[model samples]
Target: MLQGAGVVSLSGISTGAYATGIEPFRQVVTRYAIRPNPAAPWPAGLRLRIAVLTDIHACDPWMSLERIAGIVAATNALQADLVVLVGDFMVGQRYVTRIIPAAEWAPVLGGLAAPLGVHAVLGNHDWWEDPDALRRGGGPTASGTELTRNGIRVLSNEAVPLATRAGPVWLAGLEDQLALLPVRRRTGRGRLGLHDLAATLKAVPDGAPMILLAHEPDIFAQVPARVALTLSGHTHGGQVRLFGWSPVVPSRYPGRYAYGHVRERSDLVISGGLGLSIAPIRLGVPPEIVVVELGAEAVA
Candidate 1:
């Protein structure tokens, strides 16, 4: 099936090999004109277009600075009212020709621009692998620091309000839900995340529409109706989807939170994301830049 989709070559499949080296590098732009949802009502006249970039496990050949710059340019071309980055701006794959430092990658992402500004939330990788953050016992990962220094706002269980033509809009960025896995993995301590959803929601006053940015899609299940739309990544759409199914998903619910848009209590759009992890392989699912248009009719 993947072969028919042009994800893997015939020779590659004939050898019984699975990894498609090219799929990891290829990217597609996914756009959506959101339909009205009864569960999460859209604020009257409050329209927003969001461009989401996530799971950018920035590194050497897999996700190079040049490639990031290209993504930045591509995202900017979308002319979104807001840009939300759903984290993991750190190296994920072990085998790399060379590690690309944040200093180099940060400037590339600095190129990303939107009218509302580029906002971000840290991912599990940003917390676990950062030496400075680990050494200090908390906070300000190198990638987050550099991205902020370059004019992007990094949020950790924080919310920011934006002024739109329709009315006031709030962006709630949740910290990585799996922030303490490294310590837990290394020494059996609790892996509780620093995220405080209730506290974060407090920042949003009653009746103000909010958009939630969570790196992991699992948090979507907990998202409330006050949030009109929730954006997430980190699943990578299973990274190797075939016939619309991913065999190895990291989430506890497996396929439920694997990818694309889902609406339960709150509407959630999970980006397939721009990078890879664990292995340098992508099969049927390619990397992507997601653009979501809320209140699409307003623009029309």
Candidate 2:
């Protein structure tokens, strides 16, 4: 029997190398054809092809500048209509040879091309890791400020409608649900959330199809039937998964939020994410570039 930390090593480090060294550096695009809840009814003929990259815990040895650039190039090659980043741009772990500053990674991500434009949201780590942001309990976080400075649109609990070839659709991005870490508050037991789903959805006009960008899948519980789909990444497939089952997910839903497509009151697709957090490792689940195709599979 595997003893001591051998099992942990096997599940985390042995594969962690790939999570850190190999797979994440590669552009492994996984495509999904969203099937709307018949009862909820997605707008007919409103197709959208979106490229999603999330949890890019950009560090030196794990996720270098060169790696991010390559991923950007690969995503551009997909020719997606819109590219959405689901947050956690800053480094997520402490096992790094060196820390890559936002200034270094932001410009590289600015190269991402999409007709509808590149949009982003903040993640829990983006707030938890930044002292000033954690103290202020809000932006301008490094990921938010730097990403915006580089010209990538960072959405904070706001929605915008984009004109697509299929039709016009509203795209909303929620503020990170766990945006504030209560490190300063002695009595608070959990992190605070800034996400306002109701206010954000208010921006969507009636009769318009909508897509929401959220950092954590747990928020799906609060998501209503109005949203055709919700995209998120944070659990990193529980940072190690086997046969579509992740044992240590970071959400209240645990196993239910493992990875892949979730069909509930609102449809949610949680990407395995591109980088690891807490450690430089990812097991059965490799990094991925999620390509979500809406409507009649408009993406060729």
Candidate 3:
């Protein structure tokens, strides 16, 4: 009778482990609205829906190509006016048992659809592997040309005006902060210069509202108030939270900008992202696809 009890106890323990360590891999859509700030100028009746997918540390046993397909399919269903991929397309380091090249994931990512266009920016992980390689090569096997062929514009320290029924909105992307680090310490934290920010904003038309895509939320402090919204992902909502508190948040600000909407000088939204890093487990924070809807406030 004691032996039988031991077997049942072990089985229960196994089930609980799966629930805590693996089930959080299941992704969810977290939606938010970006209302026009009184300080920022927005065209009347401007309503733009943007879908953001970031930190897709594509590998095996967890973030497989099949899983990416599901994420793409769901984002397409949202029918967003603009779709932006915030970066970290490949794993930072080989912590997982299985690894998949970025090439295999490109075609799947190309499947993403948005009415206006699909845009992407590099993340720290992309820089960690090889900055030149990531810039010249879209994925592991595919070249940068391949991603462009797929109609995805990979922006780097550049801005483009997107024509909308409401008005022209400037979409700007900054170079990964990690890229500025020294050769041996590229992954370490760094800061963006005001000149770099100015260069990106130079192309913007006067009085046009801007949306910036940056991978790390730490840069939120430097963005000018003129920027209507800044979208970022890198903290992964601390990946593992206990009772809404995360013990390890990978940000200079720690728990402050760990996740969700943060209103600083500018509006910042940090996505929890779609894959895992360091450890292959998530306890409380699940993978997410962020949908942000932008509209003008009611004229009361």
Candidate 3 local lDDT, 54-168, one digit each (tens): 9898887678889999999999999999999998887754566667766678788999988789998877776565556434332332323445667788877789889898768
The predicted structure with the larger TM-score, 1 or 2, is 1
- Per-model TM against the reference: 0.91, 0.89, 0.85
RMSD of 3: 4.6
Rank all candidate structures by their TM-score, best first, as comma-separated numbers: 1, 2, 3
Off by over 4 Å in 3: 1-16, 19-21, 131-146, 180-182, 186-195, 296-300
Residue 234, model 1: Cα distance from true site in angstroms: 0.3
lDDT of 1 by residue, 119-178 (tens): 999998888788677656568788789989999999888899888877778888998888
Q: Which parts of model 1 have CA positions greater than 4 angstroms off?
A: 1-19, 39-41, 297-300
Off by over 4 Å in 2: 1-26, 39-41, 184-191, 297-300
Q: State model 2's lDDT.
A: 0.84
Cα lDDT computed for each candidate against the true fold: 0.84, 0.84, 0.78
Q: How close is each model in CA RMSD to the real structure?
A: 3.9, 3.6, 4.6
Estimate the overall C-alpha local distance difference test score of candidate 3: 0.78
**On residues 1-300, what C-alpha lDDT tens digit does candidate 2 reach at each position?**
568678877776666567556765555788898766655546666667899999998998888899899899999999999999999988888998888888899999999989999999999888877889777667788888889999899999899888876577788999987776556365476557888988998888876778899999998988888788899999988877877777789898996876888888878899989887987767778789999887654222
Better by lDDT, candidate 3 or 2: 2
Cα distance off (Å), candidate 1, residue 230: 0.7
